[model samples]
Target chain A: MAGTNGTIISVNKVRKSYYRDTIEIPVLNNISINVPEGEFLALMGPSGSGKTTLLNLIAGIDRPDEGEVVVGGVNIAALSESELSKWRARHVGFVFQFYNLLPVLTAYENVELPLLLTNLSKKEKHEHVEFALKLVGLSDRMYNKPGQLSGGQEQRVAIARAVVTDPTILVADEPTGDLDKVSAAEIMELLDRLNKEYKKTIVMVTHDPRAAEKAHTVRHLEKGELT
Target chain B: MKIPLKYTFRNLQSRRLTTALTILGITLVVFVFAAVLMMAHGVEKTLVATGSEENILISRKASNGEISSIIDGETVNIILAMNQVARTPAGAPFATKDVATVINLPKTDYVGITNVTVRGVSPDAFALRPMVKIVEGRAFQWGAREIIIGNSIARRILNARVGGTIKIGGDQWTIVGRFDAEGCGFDSEIWGDVLQLTDALGRSNAFSTLTLKLRSPQEFDSFKEAFESDARLQQFVPKTERQFFEEQSETMALFIRVLGIFITVIFSAGAVIGAMITMYGAVANRTVEIGTLRALGFRRRSVLSAYLIESLMIALIGGIVGVVLASFLQFFSISTINFDSFAEIEFSFALSTGIIISSLMFAVVMGFVGGFLPAFRAARLNIVSALRAS
Candidate 1:
């Protein structure tokens, strides 16, 4: 995984587990992978196959039990919790399976959330938020709450939030899992354009082969191991 | 970066019922806190206003109040002859011998009987206290069994109005007039000639206390010293009238304050628990939102502060409402027993700037205690677990 020159994310022998009542249940075991800059990669697996756990590791949302997870040339596993959060704010953007948009916020405010951590002035932040919403073709619905939007529109707003900060890597964990086929296809197309047009490095975890087909390369995970 | 303050406000608005119920609980606690403070302040104000700084009050050395003190006419004569005592325009010493006695009277509300103070005073009593005005009818005549009732007693006790008759021991005295004492404790007493009252109460040749007006307030120290150093007056103690009334209010005010704080502590505990439950429910419902915030690089402290601010806003609203409700109490006068004197005293609720500030601070403390654990729980939530919950 380290040999690649342009790799944006390098996973070296990563292992993760869940503990219940002091008993360990392994999720990801001895996994290694590399994602090059601007590459659209999808991780495919069945339920309980550890694909989501691996995605969380890559996104810096969770630490691995044992391994080095390097993203944008930084070993996130060695970073403290607060340091990892700062690193995530600067480098990684996430899109969740359920389109996790805060119901209290409108589309524009949801996208503006990540940029609040930046030192950008209010005028600059407004411009960035408007551009991100327009990119997702939801500029007209900028002020609409998540409840007021359709499923596809809500997913688009979540995507806008993911890319609003122009992060170094974008991680989507089953981004289309909760949408209908047409809405899911629209979301997949949006992710495709975000990759080819914006040259964003993307790591997507999905069980749908049609969603996987939109990515440049697809890797399979089975029984907590990469295959 | 921090979550915007509106986020906290909007979340509280989202759960209107829970927010309202929590605010209501806090409101009740604040109300009790402020109302009790007002009562204590009222008692102090009423008693403190009863005395003039320039006058001296003489009572038995160990007496708790004028009602329990006995000053014989010999001591009164000695006090009046002192050069420190002021002379009136007619060249008479501006002094009066007074007696205090508590008599049981039925309440105007038809409740059980309560004790009322009947004060015996000389003709010079009115000259010494210029604030006492006869508001209705004529003043009681000297050496007659006629009495002047204070405005408060006339309104609050049965058969205490002007022109009414009140039975004292075996004699019936006429209430010839109603006097207003300008909101002081004297407004709760009935006044008549000292000799007549002593005869009617079967306590002849003895006076409860002697009040003397000084030419200047600075004369108080010399006046007190003159009486204390006199071998004939050694059984009595003398103090500035202000000091005497202040001592009278001390025990009752302290009792009300301690009782109020005790009740407030108990009520605040329940209110804090109510706020805690409401905040916990908010955390449980917004698990994903919190995770999203954490994942967005807002620190755990930010999440904790957001919820804390939310709870503080609830308590603040309740405090305002409670203070507003307590202010209405100023319109009604209530009576309670003075523990030291064993007499009913009437006073209106008094709101002060200190009471307002302290009550609001108390509400904030309740919010802090209630919100702390829940906010910490929200802050320590595992990002992955929280995101996965919804």
Candidate 2:
């Protein structure tokens, strides 16, 4: 169910914290933001500014300490751990800074990882995996393992894995942090195309200014507060 | 969703050295476990196969074995006259009064001497035991100063082969034949005429045991009752030959099994620890991979089962290799002293289905114990913290 205001995600007064051996460390203050459908949003912050923390809460990878994180009209903060995992599998796709591809699997297998949780038949999974890889412009490198691929190709494979399930939301954390300027530009262009052409809603965390230029909206965080 | 088996398998294959070493540890422990069981089973089988169920052995009431039992000629005659005794074709009673004693003999390979059983038998003893076949030479004549050696004794004892002379009880006896007792306890003995042996030992008109063939195996109860109830035969005890021989092996077999299992338990501990260390290393190295799997929506249960399956596969491989290694032990014979008779008996290790199942189960248990903690740790990892690991 879409929000009445055409929002796909609604975070209300979300707060999060980290603890180190009984020492409470506040990471995110009472920050709230709403993302409209098919919107590409970038979150920028200095180190320890809680920008990635906010992205994680919105992506359903972490629960907010004192707020409701409603994605696609479901209160994900109220879901049990196992229920949250199933929900994440059905709705969220992730692209991490390190590519996070299993080294033993080929690019094709890596892309098919998320679909293993689905009830899809082998043929259906193959079709989805092929389309995702082709969408990321890496269909030719699908048979190569991570060790055999370039850093850019590995991140492209990660993106293919992210979209193979046709998830409701795409979340990227430092997607260009490990790539060269040329490869980083290519990745940002792919994200921009996914948003504008494929109508995918994307939330990204990055320190790269040029990467933020591709998003529809940009938010900044200082300390634990949004500015 | 369940984790793919190929994922688990490839992880094992990725660390070849650790996997091989852990498997080797399990294999060694399983081999020892199987070999011990085989040894104990072999001793019981060899002794149990020595007796025929239809035959009854009469010994002194309080004696341990034929070596210590004594039955006079008059009592043997009285027992042979009973109707329960079987008859030969010539209508004579199928009974034999045999004398058994132990003599020190030099072993062919070992430096020290070992006790060898020497039995003095009646002429009809061969007719009673059909399993004793002459494999290499002719049977000894009844009245001659000749003897027959069992195949095991002929092979292991110095100068005990056919066409050789052995001095026993101050009398010279020529070895005339070699008989195979189908790997029974009899294969560890030497047989000769009872009269000549009794004369040589100066125990005239007395024998050590009276062995009789019953008219039918079912007549054992009545025969034992009749023999024990007779006033003249009251000092003698009768037991089915099978029961007596089986009892002969119980103590030694039990000892072997208990001692072997104790040692196996100690060795398996080391093997379990080796498996644990290897599994811990795997979990430590794959922390990020586990997080990726969890983030992809694989349940914690799936992760636990994947690690356990990996460990089980390693142990199963080890079990197979160990069983194959233990199977080869059947070709080599070992000799040990039968505590009841104080004579050395030779038998080969025997593998059975029960031992194989036991050994494999033991290995699986080790795998389960070793893999549990590491798998639990992997499953309990916090998704956010795990993903943050480099």
Candidate that scores best on TM-score = 1
Q: Model 1 clash pairs?
A: none
lDDT of 1 by residue, B139-166 (tens): 9999899999998898889878888999
Candidate 1 lDDT for residue B263: 92
Query: After superposition, which runs of candidate 1 have C-alpha atoms over 4 Å from their true positions?
Result: A1-4, B225-227
Distance from true location, Cα of A219 in model 1, Å: 0.7
Best by DockQ, which number? Answer: 1
TM-score to true structure, per model? 0.96, 0.94
lDDT of 1 at A214: 95
For every prediction, compared with the true complex, DockQ reads: 0.75, 0.73
What's model 1's lDDT at B1? 72
Q: In candidate 2, how many Å is residue B296 off?
A: 0.7
